[model samples]
Target: MFTFEAEFFPDLTKTSVSEFCGEELSVLLHTLRRNGQLIEQLWNLVEQNGAIKLYCIAPEEDALEPRHFNRYGLEALSAVLQKSVRPPVFRVIGKTVGLSDACACENSEYYVLFSNFAAEYSPVSCGDCNLPVPLYKLPGENEDEFYALRQWQGEYKACDSLFVLSGVGEKFGYREISEVDSSLTRDGCDVCREMSQKCNRPFYYFLHRHISPLETCPRCGQEWGLDEKLHGFYAFKCDHCRLLSDSP
Candidate 1:
């Protein structure tokens, strides 16, 4: 992963952006995030020394290239920079050494999941290397690329967070997130199918089961347990349902 900084000298004297700074900046960040140009919603907005700097983490050093911007991202970026005095300057601040190495497999399967406990930015990960697959590397139409998948990530994260709290919403959140027949799982499975067809590779939908004892597929009621675990964690796999869960 690469850390990048975009510095802007907002001329508050000419056009006061203080009123719209928060709103406009949020829109810009969301636009970039949805397009997969930016990883996660995590960022730093700092104002110092007569400059406003936005720091972000990206999967690739060139992930913020102009060509990567969808129409909305472009417009948002322009709006934010219009408040600047001498245009905006962007550069890679540094590289990040993460827990998992970047996906390097030539032919690898994929799984889709998001955990509130993990800092994994991408919801899609290579089944072979157990590393994230940057959304831009996947096939999709312009502007709407990975649109549904990205939406699912946000929704899943919310549910995941609630489940982690383990309070009043725990059962509700857990069922919504991990149950195969739940709306969230259904939507995520649909996204996996679409991504699989687009990339011509297996895209499995991860079902979070902390200590499931079921030997049969929850959806199909057929045996799906593997002789040994796949990817060191997934002990059950249902090809028909495109689902995976850990052992009991």
Candidate 2:
């Protein structure tokens, strides 16, 4: 992920910056995020020296380009930026310190939508490189956005955060650990099925287990342990269930 800073200097000729910069700007930022144009919503919104500056993460250097935005996002951005003195000046500040190599699997044999509390970017990953697969790469009905995938990622992250927090989050912990049946597992499996059907490739739902290693698949009660760990992480994978899990 790349970090960028956008400075929106107030138009001195105008009495004040339009009200769009407040909540409307935030909505626009998230709209871009859901469209896969930005990695996350504006991380920082600061007002200083009569200017509003925003910081955010992007999947690529050209992620913010107009070509990447959905119709709604593009429109919202134009409406908000017009309120600035000039166009919002964008500059790359830095890259994510520990971002993995981006997925290069144009025709990956399979894909996995996997994310944890620590991961705030796209959950879909190429099975081959174990790197994030940009949401836009996957075929979707939406012209330029994978809003459904983004919504799933948000729900998954919320469940993961609760699981990580522990205590009084038994339901969340079980959801993460279970290979099937849990609401999270069901939702993730639905996403996997949809993607796989659309792409004509296997898409697996990664289930994280915090307990001891098991010799058999939890869902099917069959031998599913891989002879060699996949990506040195997934200890088990059930083709029938379209599920993968890491053993502690």
**What C-alpha lDDT do the candidate models reach, one value each?**
0.76, 0.75
Candidate with top lDDT is 1
Could you tell me which residue pairs clash in candidate 2? none
Per-residue error (Å), model 1, residue 157:
2.3
The sequence of per-residue lDDT tens digits that candidate 2 reaches over residues 82-173 is: 66566778888888676654675668888998887777677888888888876656664565356566667787777777878876885666
What's each prediction's TM-score? 0.82, 0.84
Q: Give the alpha carbon lDDT tens digit for every residue of 1-248 in model 1.
A: 88899877777775645543576667878888877668776688887776778888888778888877878878987887776677777899888766344565666755555444455577888877788876666655545657788778878888887888988888888888778889999998888788777777788888888645567899899999899888688888898978888765
- Prediction 1 TM-score vs. true: 0.82
The clash numbers for all candidates, in the given order, read: 0, 0
**lDDT: worst 10-residue window of model 2:** 14-23
